[model samples]
Target: MSDLPLRSQLAVALGRTASRMSRLAGRGDGSVIGGKIGLKLDPELLTRLSADRKLVLVSATNGKTTTTRLIASAMSGLGEVATNAFGANMPTGHVSALAAAPGARYGVLECDEKYVPLVLRETGANVVLLMNLSRDQMDRAGEIWQLAGKWRKALEGVDTHVVANCDDPLVTWGASTAKRVTWVAVGQHWREDSWCCPECGGPLDREASHWACRQCPFARPKPDWILHGDRVTAPGGRTYDLDLQLPGRANRSNGAMSLAVVSLFGIAPEQALPLLGRVASVAGRYTTVQHEGRDIRLLLAKNPAGWLEAFDVLEPAPGPVALSINAQGPDGRDTSWLWDVDYRVLKGRPVWATGERRLDLAARLEAAEVDFRVVDDIEQAVMAVPPGKLDVIANYTAFQTIRTRYGRAL
Candidate 1:
């Protein structure tokens, strides 16, 4: 195996082998094994295989995958491009993305907050974009600040240009640690969590529709070369509307932030705004499917914040909802955080609980006095779902499996 060329060796060792193992052990767990296998391969071979040679590493609590795909799409004109487009941004997925690409110029890697520091250290990317930092997957990802510390340690002394979200104190503070960086902020109409600084526990003040913190002294002014979108007009002849097809004001901010970073990368807002409006789908993110004439919206809900955001995007749970939760060890291994979600909103509506943790989901639903059925098999739950406007909300692994099943049905 060692005698084979580096690319061939990677195929034999990582992609084919790790994919088999990933499927065998289960889907999402394979990223760690993939990462370990990749780290064992030739490191210097990457630089040797480089051409056009610009890597953009984007990481955030949310919208990382979407932005990664968007950035990859915009940057494709530069040269060969590769990314963890399917939400594989960890070590092995990182190597697999590059290895899978074979030859590429610009690498638009959509990395996770937890994996950013390590990926940055290994990839030595030219441009790094940090979207925002928030509490996500507490059972697995822990706190945002803790992950920020890991990012800081992992990013020590790596020479690169960092474009950060100045609106988020945690993200801005993280970017502040970078020696050379530019900050981007947006004026959001929605009033969400903009009070306390992730650091110093200080009160953050809002000047424009956007905000900053003077207490921690953490809130730094936007750098000279920054992009600010004080106003946003949604796609369509709706003309002067403040809504988005993807749902919620938060996504607008995420989209706007991605626009800001794209602008920083030599793409103008005027040129990219039209492209941004063209975002059709991100696998299972608020994506609706037609099953037996019923419109099913599949949303990825893992943590409290994400679940809240998903719920916000939805307008009053239409009918019975199938809340699928994956409790497999690889999918965080712990399902304790289900309590954080306000299942009461789903009360009076019929519910079908499926996935590896159906019992847990049922328990949450039951506590809210919501009517539900606990099905051991997700496919059965999906199949048993009668027609007439049913909505399907799934998490990561569950979403993939559901897609594989229904994608074939289609």
Candidate 2:
């Protein structure tokens, strides 16, 4: 602490104190609040704390938190890794994470899509991971293509190495301007957001896993890394099995991206794969908690793209699915995104809708011809099902509420 500037040192100390107080008061982790107070005290604290540390900034619409957790876990093999393990992905969270772990030699930060450019510029991160781009909290984030334009401008002529997903045309367009980039072919299933080219506003032609602009020269970049099913094929044709504890192909894609990022820091995939597998749950995304003698798994799906991915990880039929949604400040004050999700997939499954915005979800499910019962309370929704394993898929605040009520396991 003494090695830092006097103001930064003071900022870190005060930030830690504030975080402790917040925890003592049972108000929350204080990650954002602490960083906010610290930044107020020392405006340059993020730069000072990020200096001399090998930092990796991860940004995406859906997998930012999971990918950040995977990278941080793998980086921990080298030494202490400072990361925002929670879903605090703004500048305040970045400042709080750096301040909390001053002695850590490495930092892996989950950055919000909107704050990626600012965090990238401030941290001067060694590697910036850009995953898929989709409509998430459209009220606050505007449009996905506009966000991609901002990323393209910010990464233009940058020295940092970029690890990007090539399957999503939007991500390809965003990271194409970077000087050094390792493209990973992590498949994108959500196509509603990117039907046209971000460069020329032309219709994009999709063929299997490849996409090309019908009007412009922009196209999918040849990937240096490819994720197929549970296996990740890296450069030199070396294939590694991604035996991750985290479910679904989305997490495997996240693992592939993490492997690519850590490899730049001299961490071999063989040594890092196990570390990635150790992350069973990230910020309660895939946590299973016992409530009312019934085991319920919690999965967070905040937007259309996220819900699409979450559907892939859901348990098989007969295992009732409880869905919860909220339009809280953290979750964006908009419930119209519900219509974007195709709920017909849950037609045959036993489903229950419960949350602050359950009516909206119920209406969407009805429109899709999916039968669901609206239960006001989550526990009641779970009780409506048979005693066994139940999967609870929820948005931001609803997920937190259920996790808290059932006792946060992660």
Candidate 3:
């Protein structure tokens, strides 16, 4: 394990060892792997990642991985950029990503929200992009709004040039009022989160699809950074046009956000747009695979918000599904929080639960009055998992497990 070729490999080995250690010790995580390793590694990284190369840290409750990869891709169109496509977002994860890069010009790392302050301070990023805030992993992560507030205050004190999402009222208020702020927003989506005022907590009255609060009478003013279009036209919290072939409004936002970061580095949109199409898929994010004559869409679903949006995007209908559940690693070991998600969203879909934590998830389905078959192992479960048209979503830890299992089936 110590002789691993890459940091991703090291992280994977450590993660597996930690999971087993946790099981033996009856602890959720093995002996503080992240913090312990982080402390031991913090000093060495500064000399390792020198001032010659730029480091841009991307942090968010969600969309960090997507934004990080897109930003890296957009940056590479201009020049050399090294990044960890793997989903390691914590301080340890960020360290591993940077260490793994042999001689990359820029370091683009998707950082975990809780570890953002420390990594940001250490990395001394030239640009820091803050995506929207939403409820995720209540068991491990506390209040969403509270964490957002704390992040806003901490980032404001930092000297890094801040780029933030403005569609979210919470982020908009924080960024719009901050120093060196370039706020970005999108046009109205079919499902929007800002209709209600996060301030006085009033319903927003749509003026022209742009939106302003009716109860509080606070209308949304455009951000300082108008990269391509207005908020609604921008779509998924980024400046989006029609040319990008990425699926879903979320990917569009990711493209726009990526372009914005690259634009800051003087990369022209026209030059970068064509190059973006050439970048390959960053695995485990809507990564598709065919298994045993069945089409499987593997999505990494984490919190309630992410799952709900994925449920909307998947629109599973009457198709078969394999919902893999695992509480190990970054997947949030506590299964009690499953109740918060709307599993009923799986209604009318042929969904079956799998993975080590399948029984735990099955219990939630029973409680929710949603019937689902409990197939303990993902491999065995895939036997019955629809072979033609199917949707499979595995959150955090389960995704890696399922990919390896179902990949064998394919």
Candidate 4:
């Protein structure tokens, strides 16, 4: 930045001051406003900051934060790496992150799907990780396929190498035109959104593990990397067992993709596995907090797919689980996605629904024939757990609320 003009440097200085003021004011994480001010002053702030860094961009509907953390952890072996660990994934967040870690040699950024093109173009990232695409925040994000189409258009003729999930047809179509791609079969369970070919608008012929378009040339490419359960097989038949603290098959897939992305940086899975395992919690997800004198493990469930994964993690635990839902800005205004989830799995278990949308969740539980009680207060919900450890799952806002109530920094 010393080579930059005086006005650009002043913009950066002002942005940093704004970031400090935002933290002092307790407004939020301060990433958005800081980057906003910087970009407002110098519109090309991201491009300027990321000029000489080796960048790896991670984008997905789910597991992006975890995957970004995993990649950032592994990249530490290479050099100083910059990332937005707080889940601010838009342009503002990217600008703020680059400014915060100005000396970092490498940047592993978790990019929002809509802003991936701009970030990629500006940063000139060498590797891009394309994770699964799903229906998330529909009112704000629009359709999943529409975003994928933008990705395809944005990536055209770019020289960056892509590591994409071959199991997802949407991802496959998005990365099809990349100059260089390393396909990874990371195992996707959500196929509801990718039932047809993005190329020809035809039905895809599906199998147990792979799919192909019946009417078009586009299909699941041959994967150079594969994940079998918790073990990931590299290109050379070398396998690394991912014994992650983060539970569930979804995390296993995230680990696989993270391994694939880092491998492009010449960091093998054997060296990256231990680093990835150390991530116990990401922004309060999959963590236990002592709040109101009960041991409450926090799980975040925002949509049907996320709820399904959260239920799988909660299934093996004890009784009287707590669930909180909210229809806030980040969680999306639509709660209709609840009906799409298979809540019958909790039929015999006792559940306590709590949050801004607690009644909506209670009504959904009733319709699903599940036994549940409604308690809107977190303290009461924690006390409602019978003698054992309390397990809690909440949507976006509710999870952050509980985390803040417990005095954890956002």
Q: Identify the leading candidate in terms of TM-score.
A: 2
The residue pairs that clash in candidate 3, if any, are 89-112, 186-231, 186-232, 187-231, 187-232, 187-233, 188-232, 294-387, 294-388
Better structure of 1 and 3 per lDDT: 1
Per-residue error at 338 for model 1, in Å?
Answer: 1.9
Instruction: Assess the local accuracy of residue 328 in candidate 3 as a C-alpha lDDT between 0 and 100.
Output: 77
Q: What value of lDDT does candidate 3 attain over all alpha carbons?
A: 0.64
Candidate 2 stretches with Cα past 4 Å from truth are none
**What local distance difference test score does each model get?**
0.65, 0.90, 0.64, 0.86
1-410 per-residue lDDT for model 1 (tens digits): 34447664764366557866786875653544554565566554333333345788889776787778667766655566877777777766676666556667668888878877766766688878887766556677887778777766665576888877666666766777676676655432323444677668778887654556666556655443333333443223122222335566556666665655565568755666556556656755766777666567777766665676676665465576777888654467677777777877777666788887788888888887878888887655656767666666777777677766665221
Tens-digit per-residue lDDT, 275-393, candidate 4: 99998888888877775566778888887778777887884633568888989999999988888887888776778888998888888899999888888687787877665667788
lDDT of 1: 0.65
> Per-residue lDDT for 1-410 in model 2, tens only?
56898888888888989998998998889998899999999988898889999999999998999999999999887889999998789999999998888899899999999998898888899899999999888889998889999999999998899999999999999999999999999898899988988889999999999999999899998999999989999899999999999999889889999999999999999999999989999888898888677888899999998999899988876568999999998899989999999888897889999999999899999999988899989978888877789999999999888888887776
Clashing pairs in 4: none
Error (Å) of candidate 3 at residue 340 is 3.2
Clashes of each: 2, 0, 9, 0
What's the CA error at residue 284 for candidate 3, in Å?
A: 2.3
Compared to the true structure, candidate 4 yields what TM-score? 0.96
Off by over 4 Å in 3: 1-44, 47-50, 174-177, 187-219, 224-240, 363-371, 408-410
Candidate 1, residue 329: Cα displacement in angstroms equals 3.2
